[model samples]
Target chain A: MNIKEISEDRLVIFKDKNTLTIKEHEKLISLMQQIEESMMPILNVNVSYNAVTVQWDIFKMDVNDVKENIQTLIKNLDHIKIETLEKKIVEIPVCYDSEFGIDQDKFDMPIEELIELHTKNEYRVYMLGFLPGFMYLGGLDKRLYKERLDTPRKKIDKGSVGIAGGQTGVYPQNAPGGWNIIGRTPIEMVKEGIPIVRPGNYVKFNSITIDEYRRLNNDKNN
Target chain B: MIRIIKPGMYSSIQDLGRTGVEKFGQSESGAMNFRAMMLSNKMLDNPLSNPVIEMTIVGPEFEVLKDITIAVFGTEKIRLNGSIVSTASFIELKEGDHVKVGRLLDTRGYIAVDGRMNSNHILGSQSVHSQLLDIHPLRKGDVIKIDGANEASLEKKIMSKYPTVKTYKGKPVIRVMIGEDAERVKNLDSFFKESYTIQSDSNRMAIKLSGTKIEADEYDIVSDVTRLGLIQVTKDGNPMVLMNDRQTTGGYLRLGTVAKVDLPILADARLESLVYFEEISIEDARALYNEEMERIQGTYYLP
Candidate 1:
C-alpha cells in the first residue's frame, strides 16, 4: 500500500502482501502527473502499473533536478487517500469443447473439471500483451499452471482461451501461440481503439453448453 | 503512382508508429528503421509523419505507372530505370521507369512517395503490425496511391548532410544503460563487456543473441512493461534485444537497453553479425539520444 522510489525517476508500488486497488492505481497516476507538471522544465515523468507504461517527454532537463522536485511532490500527496470501488464482474460465456480448444489434448484435466476450476474464482487483468486484446489474467488456480508448448502453433484461432505458467487469457486474434488451450470465449476482447477489458478489471468465465454456445455464436453472426 | 511488378521478400506501408494503444496489447507498430523513413520523408518535403513504403531485404521491383517523385533511404544498392540511385536521395520517376532494391544493404529500406499513402489509418497509424494484425505484406500488383501531387513539384534539392550509419563489425559493440533489473543480473559488468552474435531467429519482437550467459538473482521477477532496445538476458545465457513489436511486459531479467539512437542500426543488422555491449550512464544515454534527435532535425552541426 506504499509507493517506493526505486530510483530518482522510477517508482514502484510495494505489493509484497497488499495488492493495489484500482483507486490507488489512479491516484498514483494523478500524483505522478502533478509531480511531472510541477517539475515542468526540470524532468519528464514515466509511469507504469501492472505492466502498462506512460512516458512524458521533458525536453532536455537534468535528471537530478526532476528527481528532487518529484520527492517534494510525493511529500504533498500524504493527505490524498484513494479508495477502491466495488469490482465489476464480467461473465464471459465460454465453450469448453475440444474443437474450439485447439490444444485441449495437451491438458490431462477433464473438460468438466477444468470448467469448474476456471470459473471458481474471479481473475484480475494484470496487463495486456503478446497480441491485440489479449488479456494476461492472474489468479488462476495454482493446480492449472502449465508450461507452454515446446513448439508454438502457427495460428491459434481468435476467441481461443489458453493458459501458460500461472496465467490465462483469451486470444483476441489468430496468431502464433504456445499456451495450452482449454476453451474458447465468444466475446471479442478488442476492436479498433477500444479494449474489452482494461488492466485492473475483474473477469470470470461462465461455462456454456455446446448448444448454448452455438446459439450465442449464431446470435453474434446475425 | 507505382506498380509492383515483382514484390520481393516483403514490403509494407509504414509511418512513425501507433502509440497510446499498447495498453490494449497493440504493439507500437512502425518502420523498423525510423531514421531512414524520416530521411526519405524529409527529402520529399513531405510531413515527417507521413506514411512510406517499408521494403525488407531483397526488396521489390516496381514499375512507375505514372510520373512521380520518390526518395529512397536505408539500404545500400538501389537502382531506378536500371541506373543506380544513391541511398537517401530523391529522384524523379517517369512513366515506365523501374525501381529495384537489391538485397538490403543493411536489412530494411524506406521509399517515401511525395504524399500520404492511400490506405486506412487504423488506430491513428499507417504502419502495419503484420504479426499482430491480419494485414498482409505488400505484394505484386498492389497499386499504391499517393496524395498531394503538387507537393512533388515543390520538393527541395536533396539535403547534402546524412547520418553515418554504423554497422556491427566483428563483435558489434552496442551501448546500453542498466535496466530496472540490473541488480538481478550476475556479473553485470562482465555481461556488458562480453561479445555476442545476432541469432538468425531474431525479428521485430525480439533479437536473440548468442553470447556469455548472465544469470538472475534468486528473486523471481514477474512479466512487466518493457521497451524496444531492452537487452533481456534469459536463464539460458542468451541475450535478447526487445524491439518495436515486443510484448508490452516480460519476466526475464534485463541487463540494460541499447541507446535508442542505435536501435535502427540494430534493426537492420544481418543475422550472425557479432555484437558487443558497452554500459553507459543514463545521462550519457540521454545526451546521445538528444544528439541523434538534433541530427535528425538537421540542427546538429558536425565540427
Candidate 2:
C-alpha cells in the first residue's frame, strides 16, 4: 500500500491491485481507523473500495510536513497493531407484502420465498455513501441479484429497502435512486439528522407484517 | 427579522457546510460561490462561516421587519425602496424598508446580515442539503430571525478594500491541477485545449461540461472519495466538475481538479457560457491559493 498526493491538501492511500476484494476492503478500513487515531491534524479520513483518502487543513500546517508524517504511517503499517473494531449487527424490520413490494415481480421466485432468501444472510456494510445513511451492503444471495433500473426513479421513498446488482440496503431519506425496491422498513435509518448505521457495521433484515410495520412506525413518530 | 415577499427561483440559507461527516454519506452543501459568501460576511463584520442566504439566477424580494445591516455580493442590481444602491458598501435597512434583488449578472448571489441568523444546526452546519427531505428551500412569507445590533454603524469603512464585485463574462479560463488519474485519459492535452460549454442542468452538486470527447481506458473506477473541484470525465467522455454538494464518493475517472482560487469563477459561470481549462502544477496551485488568502486577510477590515 502507498499514498499519492492527489492535491496540495489531499492524498489517497491505495493498493496497486486493480480489483478490490473483501480482504482488501477490510485492510483499507483498518488503515483508515489507524490514521484517525494518530493525532495528526487531519481534517478527514475516508475509505471507499480500495482507497483511503486523507485531507488536512492547508491553512493550519504545511502540506509537505503532513505528507511526510502520512508516509511514515504507511511505511510502518505492517508493524503497527491494527485495532480490532467491535462487530455490531443492526437488525432492521421490513414488510415484504405486495403493497410495499413495488418491484417484487423482478424476482422469479414466490414473494414469501424471496423474503426468506433475502433475510437469510447477514450483509456486510462496505461503505456509506451516494446518499445520506445509504449503506452499501455486500453479500446478497445470488438469487436476488438484479440490475439497476434503466431509468432511475425520480424519488424513492424513505425507508424503502432496495436491491440492485447483488446488493441490498435501505434509503435513509427521500431522494432520487435507481435500485429496485423489495420491501419498506418502518424504522428510520437516519435519526436527529444523523445516520443510525456506520461503515464497518453489519446489517441483517427481519421480515415483518404490514400491520406490524405501521404499528412500529406510529410508535416511532409518537 | 426579514420576511420573504417573493422567493425568486431558489433561495436557501447556507454556511461553510458540514465537515468530517462525508464518511457517513453526507455531502457538503455550502454556498456555491464561497468567495462571494465570505466577502458578504466580511463586509458586515460577521464570521466568514456565518450563514448567508444564497440566491440563484433570479434573486428574492423581501421586507425588513427590523433595522439591520446587510451586504449583498455577486449582484449589483440591488434596490432599496425603489432606489438603486451601490453594492460596494453595506446597506442599512430600517423597519418596513423594501429591498429587491433583480436578475443576477452571475448564476449565484449571496446576502449576509450583520448578526447571526437563527437556524437549526444539523451535522455541524446550517447548509441546506439539496437531496434531504427535511431541509427546505426558502418560501414566500417565511420570516427569518436574526440577532441584530438594531442599528447600522454610520462610521463603517468603505468595502472598496474588498475584492471588486465580479460579473462573469466571456470565455473565462479556469485553472486546474493534474488529477491522480490523469494517466487514465489517453489524450490529456485535448482536455486543456478544448472549450467546454456549461450545461443548463448544472448545479451545486456538479458542473457538466460538454466539449471535445476525451477518451479514457475505463469509464468507472472502484468508487472513491471526491473533492469539491475534482473533474470527472463520464462514460460519454464529457467532463463534470464536482461542486460543494457532490456525492462523497463516485465511480468516474477523474481528469483534474479546478484550482481553489479559480473555483469562484466556475461557481458564477452562467449556463451555455464557454470556458477553458489551463493546467498548472500542484505547487503552483498552492502558491496561487496562498497569495489570494494573504491579500484578502491583510486588507480585511472589521468595524
Candidate 3:
C-alpha cells in the first residue's frame, strides 16, 4: 500500500495487492483529524481503503502551506496503527415472499436458496448513496449477481432488499428503482425520526418465516 | 404571503444545502446554481443562505396575497401582471398582483422572498430533496407563508449594475484535476482532448456526456463519497459529471472534478453542446473558485 499526493491538497492511498483492512481505515481517520487540528482554517479529508480521495479547503491557506501539512501528516502516519474495534453481528429479519420480491422470479435460484445464499456471507458496507440510510453492501455471492430490470419500476416499496450486479442493498424510501428485488426487510433501514445503519456498519441478514415476521411486527406495534 | 396560483414545472424550497451528511448516503441537495440563489437573496436584502423558491426551466406563477418586496434572478424572464420585467431586478408586488416567470432560456431560475420561509429544517437544511426525503414539490393551490416587514413605504429599486451570468458558449473547455484513479482511465489524453456532447439524459444528479468512449482498466470500483463537479466514467466509458443532487457514493471510475466555478456553466448547458476537458492544478482551481465567489459577493469587480 502506498500513499501519494495527487494535488497540493488532495491525497490518494493506493491499495493494489493488499486489501484495506478495518485497522488501516481507522488509522487514516485519526491521521486526518490530527492534520485538521494542526492546520489552520480546516481541510476536508476523505479516506477509502480501496481508492479514497481527500479534498481540502485551500481557500483559507496558501497552496504551499496545505501541501506541507499534508506531506507531514502522511510521513507521521507510519507510526500510528489502528486498533480493531468489536464488530457487532446484527440479525436483520427478511421475508422473501414472491409478491414482495417482484424481481426475484427473474433469478434462476429458488427463493429459499436465494435467501440462504444471501444470509451465508457477512456483508460489508462499502458505501452509502442514492438515498438516506441506503447501504451499498459488498461481498454478495457471485452466483446471485444479476442485471437490473429492463425498465425500472416506478416505485420500489421501502425496506425492499434488492440485488444489482454483485451488490445487495435495501431501499430506504419508495422511489424509482432498477435493482432486482430479492426480499423485504421488516426493519426500516432509514427512519424519518431516527437513522438506523450508518456507513462502515457491518450487516448480516437472518432468514425468518412469515409467521415469525408477523409476530415480530405485531410485537413492535404492541 | 404568496399563493401559488400555478407552480409551473418543478418548484421547491432550497437553501445552501445540507453538508456533513454525505457519509450517511445523504446528498447535498441545494440550489443547482448557488450564485443565482445568492444573488437573488442579495437583491432582496435577505441572508444569502436563506431558503428561497427554486423554479425550473418553466418558471412558477404566484399571486401576492400581501404587499411585499421580492427579487428575481437567473435565466427566466420575469413578468408582473402579464407584463415582462427585467431580470436581476427587485420589484415591489401589491396585493392581487400576479407574477409569472416566463420560459427559461437557461435551465433554472431563483426567486428570493424577503424573509425566511415557514418550513421545518430536516438534517439541518431547508432545501427540499423531494425524491429521497419524500417531500412534495411546490404546486398550485399551495399557499406559502413568509416572514418580513410589511409593505411600509417600500420603494421598488433596481441596481444599475448586475453581475453577468456567465455561460459556456461554443465548445466549453471544462477544467478538471486528475482523479485518484487516473491510472484506470485508458487513453487519458484522448478522453480529455476529444469533444463530447451533453446527453439529453443529464439531470441534477448526473450529466451524461456522449461521444468517443474510453475504456477503464477495471469494471467495478468500490463506491465512495463523490463530490460536485466530479466527472465519473461509467461502465461504458461515458463521462457523467456528478452535480449537487448526485448520489453520495458511486462505483464509477472518476476522471476528475470540474472546477467549482465552472459548474454553473455545466448546469445551464444546453443539450447536445460540445464540451472538452482541460487539466488544472488544485491551486488554480481553488483560486478561481475563490475569485468567482468574491466577485459575486461584490468584494471584487470583474473587468
DockQ scores of the candidates: 0.39, 0.68, 0.43
Docking class of 2: medium
**Taking the candidates one at a time, how many backbone clashes does each contain?**
4, 0, 0
Encode model 3's per-residue lDDT on B58-87: one tens digit a residue.
Answer: 788889998777777655358899897776
Q: Tell me the spans in candidate 3 whose CA falls farther than 4 Å from its real position.
A: A1-18, A26-81, A101-114, A138-155, A175-178, A215-222, B149-171, B183-195, B215-220, B299-303
Off by over 4 Å in 2: A20-24, A75-77, B148-170, B300-303
* Tens-digit lDDT string for candidate 2 (A12-126): 8888876678666777787787778886777778877668888877888787787777777777767766555578899999999888889999898899899999999988888
Off by over 4 Å in 1: A1-52, A60-78, A101-111, A147-154, B150-172, B217-220, B299-303
Query: Candidate 2's residue-wise lDDT over B238-283, tens digit each?
Result: 9999998898888789889988888888888898988988888888
Q: State in Å the error of residue A102, model 2.
A: 2.3
DockQ metric, candidate 3: 0.43
Clashing pairs in 1: B172-B274, B172-B275, B172-B276, B213-B237
* Number of the predicted model whose lDDT against the real structure is largest: 2
Worst 10 contiguous positions by lDDT, candidate 2 chain B: B161-170
